[model samples]
Structure formats: C-alpha cells, structure tokens
Target chain A: MCAAASSPPAANPDRKSNAGATPDPWEACARLEYGGDRSPAWSVREELLATPPEGWPAAETRLLKSLARADATAAGRAFLCQMLALVGSAQSVPALAALLKDVDAVESARYALEAIPGAEASAALREGIAAVSGSAKAGMIGSIAIRGDTSARYLLAGIKGNPSEPAIVREAAGRALEHLATAKA
Target chain B: MPTASTVTRRRFLQQSGVATAVAAAPLILPSGLRGAGAPSRKITVGIVGAGNISDSHFGPLLGDPENVRILAVCDVDRERRDDAAARVNRTYGNQDCKAYGDFRELNRRSDIDTVFVCTPDHWHALVAIDAMRNGKDVYVEKPLTLTIQEGRALVATARKYHRVAQHGTQHRSMKRFHDVAEFVRNQGLGRLDRIECFIPPNNRHVGATWKPEPVPAGLDWDMWLGPAPWRPYTSLGCHYNFRFISDSAYGQVTNWGAHYLDIGQWALDMDASGPVEVEGRGEFPSSGLFTNATKVDFTVRYANGVPMFCRTRFEGGGTVRFVGERGWLDIARNRMSASHNDLLREMQAPGKKIQLPLSNNHHENFFACVRSRQRPIADVELGHRTTTVCNLGQIAMVLGRKLRWDPAKEEFVGDAMANRLRGRAMRSPWALI
Candidate 1:
C-alpha cells in the first residue's frame, strides 16, 4: 500500500476543536512518516512555498504553533522545520533558536537555520554555541563555520583553548576556525 | 560548466616537480636506468569503502603492471574492510595491508600516494577532498558527489593541491564510448540537435515504510551515516541498498544517470559547462523505504540549443543516443547502434580526427596520471560538471518547476530556494571546507 495512504492523522487532538476557522493545514504533519507517504505534508509545503511575502507571517505562525504543540511528534516537527527553511523569515528565529538546545530537535533546527539566511539566523547559531555541549555543541559549531560568520572566530578560539571541553568538540572548533580562516583567504 | 583551463601535460609535470630530476640531469637517463620495473615508480593506494563497488577496482589494482600497491582498505563495516585487507595481503603474498574503520586514518598516511573513494554518494566529497588536501591523488566513484556544491568543492580542492584526480566514469576508458564521443564531436552524425538518455527503472525492492533493525555485528552504523543526518539502523538502508534511499543516494538518477549522462556530456563537448535551462518531473515512492524517484522525466537545454532529455523506462536497454540532423548514435554497455553503418565505419579511419586520450583501463589510467601528473580522461572538473547535470535534474524534479541556471556562478538565477538546494549542511563535525 502507499505509505501516505496508511498514515494516521495528526496526533494533536485539540487541533480539530476549531470547526469554523480555516482548517489547520499542518494537522496531518504530526503523524507523517519518513520514507513513507508524505504527499499530505508535501501538499502543505507547496501551499507554504506559494505564500506571498505578505502572507509569510501567517504561514510561519501556523507552522510554529504546530511545532510547539505538546502532542506534536518529533517527525512532524522536523517536517515543519523543513518547510520553515524555505518561507521562514526573522519571525521564525526565536522558536528555532530554542530548538538549538534540544538534543532531539537541534538537528532539525540546524537544518532550517542554516538555510533561512540573514543575520538573525547567524546570531542564533552563535548564541547556541553556549547552550549545548558534546555532539550538539560540535554540530552547532560546524553550522556556524559553514555560514562563514567571522564574528564567531573569537568564540570558536575560546572553545579550542578551553581544556574542559571534550576533545571532539575542541577539535571541531579548531577545524571550524581553520575553515573560516580559509574562507577569508 | 566552469571548464578547467588548458594545462599542457609537460607544463603540469613541470609545475608538479615530477620531471625535475630529468630536467636537471646532464643527459637523458641510460636506457637500463629507465626500466619500468623500478619500485620508486609504484603508486601506493588506499581503498576506502570496501563495499560492492570496490570489487571492480580490486581486480585491476591487484593484477596490474606490477607497480601499483594496495597499502590499506577502510570501511565502516569491519568484516568488509578486513576481508578486503586480507584479499590485498593474499595477493601480494604478505600481511602488509592495513584495515581501518575511519577513512581519515587512511587519508593521513603519508605513504599512500592515491586513494580510491568508493564510498556511498554522501561520503564522496568528504573522503575525496580530505585525501586531496593531504596530498593524495583520488579516484572517486561516479556521480562525483551527492550535491552540486560538493562537486564544486572537490574540483577546487584538486586544483588547489595540484592533485591528479579521476572520476570513476569507466565507460570513457572503453573504446566504444570513445569512438561515439569522437564521432559526435567531429559531427559525424551531422548537426547535433538532441540527446536522449534512457535510464532503467529503480531495480531494488523496498517497501513504503521501514522499521529500525538491530545494528549488525562488525558494522559501525554511525560511521556509515557520516555526514548525512543521523538515522536508525536498518538492513534495508545499508550496503548496496543505500543507493535506493534518498539520504545516502539519489536512486537510479545518480546510480545509472551518472554513467550515461557522463557519456552525453563528453559527446556534447560540454565537460566544462552545462545547460542554462532545466525542467523535469518525477514520481517518488509515496511512502516506503525507497524514497528516491521511481519515475524520472527531465530535460536540460544547453546554450548551443541542443536539449538532453533523461527519462526512466524499461525499454532502450538504458542507452544514451546522440541525435543529429543527419543520424543518431546510441551507446550503452556493449551495445551500439547508428542510423548509418558508414558513420561507424568512417570513425575507424581515425586520421585527422578530434581524438580523445585513450586508456583501455581506467585504473591504469589513474595510476599513469599519478606518476605523470597529467589530468586523467575523466578529470575532477569533468566529473563535477556531469554530476551537476544530474543534480540539476534532481532539483528540478523535486521543485516541480523550471530552473534557470548560471553555470559560471554555479547557482540558480534569482531563485533563492533553488540555490539553497545546491548544498546541504553537513551533519556536525563534518564540514566539507
């Protein structure tokens, strides 16, 4: 059977209580399965991409609200993040910034923030350097380096010098610094 | 299609310091001293990703002109790497081949002069770039990279290091492909109008959804994922099956497309550049372990007004046909057909022809270039450009729209979303730069 055909509805039970308002487009995302039927979510993404500049706030708001729902599944939120990476603006930064500290959500957050563009996203990644450690911290450092945010050089240098940081994280910071230096060259 | 600048073989060797001793010699070396059996002439190699593709490389490297050495084999799977190491040692009648779970360890070895990056698509750029940066020539498997951005990075790295890099488009080494490419280049078929590339359907059998399975013994699942985003282990997603998954591979589009599209690019003489406009649509597995497109129909229009159409179907024996105003020439593995037999006949005359460099064996060609410091037949720049064609088709398929591409800038024209798709953020601690 088609994987999308067998998927269950979005797990948020409260989402259906609003009968009169425009149907929540993302209600089906919470139960979206990877490597399975994603047409339902893809359709919503197409809608989001087609949104005009003036309507981006509404679309971003809806996705953020769905992402914050207590019952929203991790897979569902990741899907939302994929959409936000495309149409999202500065308004979506804070919600995504919070995800930088989430072990489960940080990867998804990085996926979005890395593509969102602009200074806000770069700042969130810079600040995120302190909020996580180990692999999470190492990953955020990699993202910052890819952005070529020269402002993070001092921050990365400090991490490279600190003895308390794990060797992997320290090595990652050192490598990231080298990458930024090469970019400047 | 940012083509490589014309660097003559003699100039390349001079710049690379390969012929410095000869240039400084009072006279040419005595004939006896110029023997080909010198141990100093050996090209030491390390094979990364000892998976299925490694089989094709081993046969040539192990039984060669007696100068190529397999010093090490690396794979995330312990069993595979150990088996490859054992095979190499057995062939050499010694226990010298090292096995490693991390390619970085292999890349760091100064003794290794070249690396065979046979890893899955996602790991290609990271492994190959690291090898080049460490002064090792590389033979990266076809498709070149998982993303367009990775291919560009690889080309830049090779030029920066002056490393002799070859892409694993072995068809170019075969006489048949070389003949057809030369014929088309010489306009044997008349005015080139269109090129059609027929790809076979996705052959792997996979269900709509996949469930996580136990990490098997001797397999480092995390290492296998490498730069790709983290995911649970599943037998269906590892080994050869990785090609069917979206994260690790781009299905048959890259798996088969890379081979056929490579020939098309060579025939069209567009190795340094590519189509300015592209559009396509494809059918992806709606919900299954196989997320790559199952049905692909895409077209890219070159600046010369010729359009190359790539489509998936069971017919055509999965061939690439160069169509011209007068006739067409079709080519595939051990398969060839032409509108007129006279064209093929005339190509055999071979005098005053736009002949491409010939290498009956791909591995031997790479080793030759490693010592000679000349670009291989399928250099990294050509590999990147061919891969760019595949990646552009994929991006167009996913976006379901036409995209205007700037080959020089290597970006989509005025399309931020499309440009963003050129590359993805490497899963942390694995930056390509």
Candidate 2:
C-alpha cells in the first residue's frame, strides 16, 4: 500500500543555518519530509510574494537553488515548482526542465513549465519530450500543445509516426498535434 | 420620457424578450412533453460516474423509460458501477445494462447517443470531451471544467463534433430561478445595480495530516485520479470527499457558486461573456489535505460595471439576489423574495410579455435538445462563461489582489501569475485537449 499523500509539510530539523540577515528558510522547508508541516514555508512564500516586483530575483534565486538540492523531497520540489510557476521567469526554465528527468518530479516540473509563458518554456518542454519517455514524455507533449508551440510540430509528428514509441506516448503526440491543429483552425 | 433609472415595462419588454410575470405555470408542465421526439425512438444513454449524483440523473431518466434507455453505467469504483448497472437492470426487468470500469469502453459503443458526465470537476473535461469526440452529445454537471483552458477545449470539441452539450447548472431550468432571471433581464428590478450570490462552504472537512491507506478492493485509485496529480489514496480523499481537495476539485466556489453565479450571468444577460475585473479574500485550511477555500468573498465586475458579489454564508442554503435602483429580488430553490411584497403584482402590468427560454426539467431539457438538435437551456458556452466567473474569483482569492480580465480573450491582463492558475497541466496519458 502506498503511503497517503497530503499537503506539503514543515521546517527541516537538519537545516544548516546560513550566514546572512533574514536567512532564507525556503531550503529548510524544501528539505522537510512528505506530509510534514508546511505552514512556516507558506508564511515565507507569502512574504516573498508580498515583496515588490524587484524582490523576485532574489527569491527566485533562493527557490531555484532549493529546487536543485539533491536532498530535497519530491514533495518539496513539487511545492517549490508551484511557487516558481507563479513567480518564475525564463531563467527558471532550465532548472525546471532538468527536473523533468526525475520520474517523481516530472509532473510538477511540466506543470510549472506549462504556465511560464515564453518561447523558452515551450523549448524546454520540446527538449524534455526528447529526454524523457513513457508518461513523462507524453505529459511533456501535452505541455507543448498547451503552450501552442508550433515549432514542435515536426517533433510531435516524428514521435507519433515512430512505431518504437510506446502506444500511450504516440497517442499523446497524435492528440497534441490534433489539439494544436484545432487551435490553429 | 423615461431615463435609464426609470425603466418602463414596455421599454423593458422591447429591449429583452423575457417574461416578468409572477405565475409559475410555465414550470408546471415539462417542456419535454411538447418537443420530445416520437415515443417509439428511445435516446440511449451511458452514464459515467455512478456515485450519489448519478442517482439524481438515472432516477428521472429511468422514469421516462419509454423515451430513454439506460444502456450502461461506468465508474472507476467497481462496487458503485455494478450497483448502478444492477439498479438499471432491475428497473427494466432485464440484464441488458452493462457495467463498465472505464468510460472509454462505454463511449466507444456506437449505439449510445448521449452521455451524462457526473464525474468530479477534474474529470469533467476529459470525460465530456472524449464522449463528444466519439460522436456523443453530453450532459455535464456544473462547474463544467476544472480550468478555463479545459472549458475552452470542451466547448471547441462540442462545436467541432456538433454535439448537444447541456450544462447541469440546473438553476437555469428551475421556475423560481427562471422567474428571477426574467425579472432582472426585463428591468423589473429597474436598472440593475449589483448581483449578490450567497453560497455554502465545503460540506466535508479533513484533518491536517492523513496516512494513505491501501487501495480499496474494488476501487481503481489511479484511474480515479485520472488527469490529476498523482497522490496516494486516502480513504477520505476519494468519492464525495474529492470536492474538498485542491488537486481533485475547487471546493464550494465551484460547487455551489457555479449554480448561483450562473444565475447572475443569466440575469445580467452576459451568457456569452464574463466579468472584466475580480478580487477577493479567502479562508483556506492552511495545513490540511484540503486546500480549497472554506469561505470566500469575491466580487466580479462586468464590463457594464455591474458587480456580482459572491460570499460564503454558512446558512440559508444559497441564493442569487439581484439589487437594482428600484428594488431587489432574491431567488433560491423552490422560493423567491423581493424588496416589496407587491413587486410581482406591479411588474404584472405588462405590455408585451418578455419570455426567456423555458425549461422546467433540466434532464428532460437535455434529452429534448438531443432530439431537436437545438441548443439546450444551459449550453456549454454559458457554462464556460459562468465557470469562468467562479474560476476568476478563485484565482483572485489565491493571488490576493485585483486583476484585470479580458472576457473576449479569456485571459488575465498582463498578469502571468494569474494566467498560470487559469489551467493546470493534466497528468500524463490523459491529455486534457
């Protein structure tokens, strides 16, 4: 039986203190176990979002680094990706796209990338489709279609026609292409 | 010479062809009786989602056995689908009804003419869109899609397939709601000032932490979570309780507000369009598995400057109250009230009666439209527009700021953060489009 999944949980007991004024706690929150207390992290998130537009770069820097931590839980990464989806820019795309390689983290990675509007976001999805396989690849195809990345038209066509690709992936590619065509029409 | 404030009954009737009289005669007779096709030809139906809501649809549909045939029932839960199919079989005194673990199998049956999508919000778009693509008309429950993008896709698919898509925002079919909408549309309220919709909060609650249990014997947990983010099964997170969770549903805002807010759009005569600005505050369970708003206070302003205020009130069921310069009228299930006792009587001094599309029975309306090939009382586009209002308020609550919206483009103005919340990426192998 799989363990129950709930909202993201709390602060990390093993978090190492950084030397600075108002040290960033996002890393600590990102290290918390699945279903741990996330209130402290949510407070920090609120504070970060409440900050003016100029304060986003620093917050994005902290969040992106936390997302890259090998020790961070997949649950934590998913939560961070959600925050980044709201506040992230093109700079956050590569890290997000990289996380698409992690099986557990792939959904959240594509979720964040799907929302961040830019040619780069779609490009990351197109690249992620080639890098990942199975459901992850199919999901990335969906993200590209949602982003309306016409540039991926050839890529999708190739996957859809490839007999080697899994049926699910090929069907997803076909559906994405159909959806994009309908969108164009 | 009547100004905007002084809305004459004749002028109102001229501008909008909706009825303003107080009589309930229009609802007493089912519209299906008049327009329903030949009794010999039955409209075969396959209902997806055999939980509590399925009973509401199947019961009435089964009652019209001569005109409607229950061919199949589908659900991810084995017990529920089997029970629903058994019930249908029992009603017919035969073993003809088939139980399906997956809706796709049922949708593939070329004989089934229409589908009733009573699935959860997250599954609404995927199921309905698939059914339409397979050449089936659909009657989908309220808060049509989980996201604006999904709603757009569903509408496009419906148009492409030429399916008779009826939204289950049944208030549009009820007599009291119709009267209220007609009253407002005919300016019986005298230059509409604002609309107020009161909705209830989440009916169920969950604790801060939960341990996932083993998947139940008869339930397919993965299939149930279709298109939603993968999560381990908690006994409390499945079935009816899915409404409380953010991943699976949008809580009371979409649950109850979808019905009430829909009436506001109808009364405002903005069925094809939506609000231009929205802002709100919400109270969510900060730590619980349930992530949707428990209480929400949001106001959506139309381009015409009529603001529809939706608030969560713990009592009095739910109502859509339209306030105007002259008076106010509030309508709920089986009842309606106005600022003055004689308001209905005064409005009865009608020149030419303004009659809106009349639908007394929502399910029957769907079946009638299935045969007539006309747009139902609650069309998919109207559902999308209403659901858009609910989602905009929800997004505004989440962002905690006022945002500009372009109803035509169906996107937030210069706000990527808000736009991000408009649609979520569906989980793999279940492409939303």
Candidate 3:
C-alpha cells in the first residue's frame, strides 16, 4: 500500500468524524481502520477526546489499549502513535514499546516514544536496542539519540563499532553516540 | 497591486550594495488577463525542482484548474524533470508542457509568467533571483535562502524587479496559525514577554563516510551541486536528502525551524527586526556524510529584554509558544491553543482579537498576489526576515557563542567569523552573484 493511503484518518480527521457537539480523535482514528461510515464508534472516541486534555484519562486508557492490540496495522499504529506523541507519557510506553520489532510501526512507535519525555521512553528504546534490525534498528537508535539518552552509550558504541552491520545503521549509531556525548557536554 | 517603483528600487538596490541588477523588461501582465476585458486564463508556471516536495505541490495546483498551467518542468535530474513534465502534460491531456535539465532555460521562457523554485535550500537563492531578474513572479520554497547575503540580495532584487516572490512557508497562509499570531501580536496574551521555539532536528539517511557512489544515470551531478561546494556523487547528497548536509543547507534548523520560527516571528511582529543577540549550544557530528547540527538549545534575545529559548523539540515539543504576563499561546501545525481556556474564549472582547490579513490556502494566495500585485501572505522580505532568525540561530550554534546581530543592517555586530559565515564560496561554474 502507498504511504498516503496506509491511513486516511491520520491526514484528514473530519472525513471520519461528522461535525457534532464534540469531535472524537479515536473515532477519527478508528475510521481509518474500520471505515468512515462507522460513525457511532468514532463518535465515542471523539466524545471522550472532548473531555478536555485534563480529563483525558478515559481517552488515554482506550488509546493505550488500541496500541497494545497485536492486530494493528503499521499505518493504523502510526496514526495512534502520532496522537500519543503529543499527549502520551510513561504509561503509554509499554504498548508502544511492544511495537519496536514491528518493521512498519517501528518508525512511528519510536517517534511517539521519542517525544514522550522521561526515563521510560529512553529506557524503552534502549531495551529495544537488540530486538530491532534494519531501518527499525537504525530508526530506534536515532530516536534514542534525539531523546539524548546517554544511557544507551554502550549499545550505541557497539553498533558504531560493528563492521558487519549496514552502513546506515552503523552511521546512525555513530551519530547518536556523538549526540549523546555533546548533549552531556 | 503595488507598482514597481523605479526610483525607490534604484535607491534600495544601491543601499543593499548590489552594483547592478538584471535590467528587467517592463512588466507584462499574463496575456490571459490584460486590458479591461479579457477572458482570464491560467497563470503560466515553470516548476523548477521536480523532487518529492515539488510532487506534493502538483496535486494542489492541478486540483485548482483555475490557477495552474505548468508550461515546463526543470531539474538537474533528467528523469525526474521528464516525469514532472509528463505529469503536467497528463493532467492537461497534452504534450505541450516541456522539460529542461537547467533552470535557466525555464527562466528564459517569456511565455511563463510565474516560476516555482522548489529546489534544495541552497539552490533557492539562485533560482528565485534568476526568475525575479527575468521579471517572472516567483513562489520559492523555504527556508527562503541559504545565507544572509542571499536573503538580502533576494529582497533587494525582488523589489528592484517588482516580482511577486512568495516565500514557501505555508503556515503563514493557514487560518489556525494566523489566529494564534494575530492573538499574540494584538496582546491577547497581554504584554508579550518572550517566545520559546522548539524544533527537532532531522536525520536524512546518508551514510557516515565520504565514500562516493557512481553518479546515477540521467542525473546531472554537477548541476545538482549548483552553487554548493562540489563533491563526488552520493545519492543522499542529492534530492530531498541534501537538507542534512550543512554545506548545502543548515539542516533542520532551517528545514523545520522555517515553519516553527517563522510562526514565532510572525506572532512577535519581529519580521522587520529580529533578536538582537543569539546564543546557545548545538552539536555537530565530528565525522559524517551529514553534518547539520544534531543537537541545539539556542537562545535568541530581542532588544526589549524578551528572550526566546530555541530548544530541542523535546523541550516544548515542535511548536512555538508565546509567553506573556497574562498568559501564553501555543501554535503547532496540528494545534493552536492558549494557556487558559478563558483567554481563547474571551479573545474577541472588543479590540482584543487582532485580525491579520487573511489567507487560508498557500498556493492560491501566491497566484492571487501574482494577479493582484499585492504582497502574498509570505512575501519575499517577510520570509527573508523569518529565515534570517533561523540562519542566525544556526550560525550561533556553529560558533558556540552569543553573537550580536544588527537586524537593521542585516549583519553581525563585530564578529568576523560570524560575518564570513553569512555567505559561502560557491563552486565554480555555478554562481548566485
């Protein structure tokens, strides 16, 4: 599938959520996976989202559960990850962390994890250090770098020194290493 | 439409230290709309860069049948250029739209009334200046120019020629952002204190070494390196990936900062003047094919004691926030919000809400200005000023010290090193000057 069609709701939300008293983010998101015609489902997600961010606990719990689902598409997962990237926290890490091995969602998952401030997101990326390979591996390493996670020095150093790994990943490791060092300075 | 004032243009050119500009021919209104009564036709366009970003523009322009007539496509990459031209021809159901390996050929065509400079940031100055000098209105991509000198020259030259050059910072045309900027500008936030800019760096997938790959077929490697230092062919060093390489551009500092910082400046009403001092920390790679600042925590301070913190996206998370005594307002591409709900609710409390000149579509706004001769939402000079903040921020990060800036003069106060960094020695056979 092309990148753009991978998920419709990520780019255009209103297409899914009909204008109402409250627009839903999840229903807007679910309309991506299920269909825009599933108006009632997205309405709940939107209604929950309308509870103001301070009252988003119910909304947050539902999103985390959706993220935790194993049946999620990379595009579907990325849509969720993008939303969470804005408001997610330590509690959102485990569900997102489980996807680091996901060849498709790794980038989006890492992006969400990267933005969620704290030791947990960094810890999640560092822990996924061994599980991911290819672009997923490279992406996680870079995300860890963007997070300025110095704790990954050992992991990054190993990748930087690895001869057999692809140049892209090794270069990313090297760059991430420099980032960690400079951030410390 | 603001008429091209010849006397003022000459004086401004002299003041800008441009010895001479291309003596542009008299303005020719698009044949479609001339005299008092002519059937309006599509504004003729020559798309100058056929990369992925340029492709994004195709859909919108093609969708708006009223505005687009892509007369030609040009790129250093032959295959890409032909592909773009083919798309245009396909959309128009004709093979009349031509393709060129050089942008100059595109600029030379009198039939084309407007030009879109969608090349790499480094190529922005040259392509836009060439179009302006040739008397074609331009819609160039952001960060508008790669250097301070390029920016100053572009602003002066655009005026000297009286071309409607829209700097490609799209958010300026978006209603949500215009709302936030107008709010902060009109003091809805009460006594604007400081603006905090948070932009993340980008990592284009170029490998770590200078190991050159063979030049790809149908690609003019030297032409692609136009005005930038020449190096052996690397796929990553070309196309959209070139943003990560500092020699060609200032990386994400301009790439993303152009969006976020432009919002910051727009809200602060600081497009005409910028931060008096810039300082902060940035981390560059010691050895890599890509060398833009990977880590930055820059602080740009305005003359009014309002200090803006330019930090990693993690700090405030890829948005621009205006903080003031009453409250704060935040703007991101996805969201625009205030610190308190009541502030946003009570925004229209009579003379409280400021309404900026309106624009909701980026491409249409440019086309409209081209027809009207009025400045677009993101005019060349305004775009230059916003980009100047980004360029100066990157310069400060690279130098690792606070440097004084003379925004009025568009120069560094006294730092010799910083002054030199304003412009680069373009590779021979390609010149912006």
What is candidate 2's CAPRI-style docking category based on DockQ? acceptable
Tell me the chain A TM-score of model 3.
0.73
Candidate 3 on B1-433: residue-level lDDT in tens? 1112334432322221111111111232332322111125567888999998797788887776654678899988888988888888898898999999989889989878889988988889878987887878899899899988789868877886777788889998676787778777787777888788788755544225555688889998878877564456877567766888876888778877888888888877786789888875665553346766666667787777677777766444588888889988787888877888987766544454445565556776676656655566788888999889888888777655567899988888866556656765343223333
lDDT of 1 by residue, B1-433 (tens): 0011345433333332332222211221221222322335666889999988999999978985256789999999999999999999998999999999999999999788889999999999999999988878899998799999889989888887777789998997788887788888888888998899989887357344577788999999988998887777888788888887767888778988988998889888888898888877766553456767767788888888788888997665588998888888888887888888877787666563575655555776666566656677778988999999999998877766677899888999867778878888777667766
- lDDT of every predicted structure (CA atoms): 0.78, 0.78, 0.70
TM-score of each: 0.87, 0.88, 0.64
Error of 2 at B181 (Å): 0.8
For candidate 3, what is the DockQ?
A: 0.01
Model 3: how far residue A39 lies from native, Å: 58
Off by over 4 Å in 1: A1-25, A33-39, A46-57, B1-39, B203-207
lDDT of 2 at B297: 80
Per residue, candidate 1 scores C-alpha lDDT tens digits across A104-154 of: 788888888987888999999999877888877888888888888899999
TM-score of chain A of 2: 0.80
Report per-candidate DockQ.
0.23, 0.24, 0.01
